[model samples]
Target: MSREEAVQRVAALIKGIKFCMLVTQTDQGRLHSRPVTTQEQDFDGDLWFIGGKDTEWVHDISQRPEINLAYAQPDGQNYVSITGRARLVEDRAKLEEVWSDFYKAYFPEGIDDPNVQLIHVDTHGAELWESSGKLASAFALAKGLVTGERGDMGSNETVSLE
Candidate 1:
């Protein structure tokens, strides 16, 4: 697909989904994964998230910086895997902009808490897959009839494109 097409597809996926699993390398050089609150996608390959400073992910990412972020539909069909280096951003203004009702369920005290943090992952690459196979593909066709667009999925190098 063309650059714009790829981006549009990624944006659509991000819009339809919110939660993602962020994996980071620990101090002892071990891989660890955790579910984090995804904030927003500017559709420019940068994803925003909020987490705690004292969290294990914060410690691991602080030392290694490298990370892998994966998002998938609950049915286990559509999925996106992004790899990149995460940079910690502590800007207060940006924090309030991405809040949702779900966040309060996790952090009731909100962003002012010392543990509150934001992470920006510069996605260098990604592998996206959607199992809209034979059975589901037909559903996509029907949806396209109404929406005027088809759901196409696969993987690509977001980092190399730069």
Candidate 2:
């Protein structure tokens, strides 16, 4: 598929996914991943997440801006992996823009909470895998068995956002 088409598909898949695993490297050189909610908005080749400034992941990002986000929609058999650079954003306007009631459970003080912070991920590139579903999966398996070769199981593509 064309790069433009792949970008569109990646945005679509991400829109359907509510949560993603945000991976960051610790100062100790170990990888750490945590589940983060994606802010509700158009993808636009960037991702925003809300977190506390005191969180370890935030600290990790401060030390190492390079990160990865993994999104999976098991129901649709769609998966996306994004590599990017992240930075802490303390903009109040942006905070109000992405704030939602769901975050209250984590930050009881609301958007004004002193510890509340925004994590902005500037996406560089992404890899996506979209499965064709059960019927197609069965067909692929059968075809593989008959031909003794790997059949087309799904669509996989790499998209450049930068």
Candidate 3:
């Protein structure tokens, strides 16, 4: 697919997913991953997420900006893996731009909280896999059982945002 189409497809696949795995590298070089809500917005190669200044991942991003974001739609068997560089965004206007009530549960003090911070992930590239459905999987299984051949799974592609 073309670059723009690829990004659009990734956005569509992740639209219904409320959360995704945000992976960062610690000072010890170990990968740390945690669930973070997916901000409601169009995926135009840049992703925004909320966090706290004192949070470990924020610190981790400060030291190492390279990161990965993984999103999955289990029922549809659609998944996306995105590699990018992350940085702390302290812009008040931008923070307010993406603020939501769900965040209050995490930051009791609300957006004004001294610790509140925004993470900006600049996309590098992404890989996506999407299956047709259970029927297709069953068909694949039956095909394998009878013909010993794997049936068509679905579509998979690697996209570059750069």
Name the better of 1 and 3 by TM-score.
3
Rank candidates, TM-score, best first: 3, 2, 1
> How many residue pairs clash in each candidate at the backbone level?
1, 0, 0
lDDT of 2: 0.89
Please report the TM-score between candidate 3 and the true structure.
0.95
- lDDT per residue for candidate 2 within 1-162, as digits (tens), equals 565666687889889678899999998999999999999898887789999889999999999999999999987788999999999997889889999999999999988889898989988899989888967977999999999999878989888888
RMSD (Cα, Å) of candidate 1?
6.9
**Model with the higher lDDT, candidate 1 or 2:** 2
RMSD of each: 6.9, 1.6, 1.1
CA lDDT of each prediction against the hidden true structure: 0.72, 0.89, 0.90
Top-scoring candidate (lDDT): 3
Tell me model 1's lDDT, rounded to 2 decimals.
Answer: 0.72
TM-score attained by model 2: 0.93
For model 1, the superposed segments whose C-alpha errors exceed 4 Å read 1-3, 40-42, 74-76, 134-161
Top TM-score model: 3
lDDT of 3 at 153: 80
The digit string of per-residue lDDT tens for model 3 on 27-141 reads 9999999999888888888999999889999999999999999998888889999999998887899889899989998899999988898999999999999887878977887
Inter-residue clash pairs, candidate 3: none
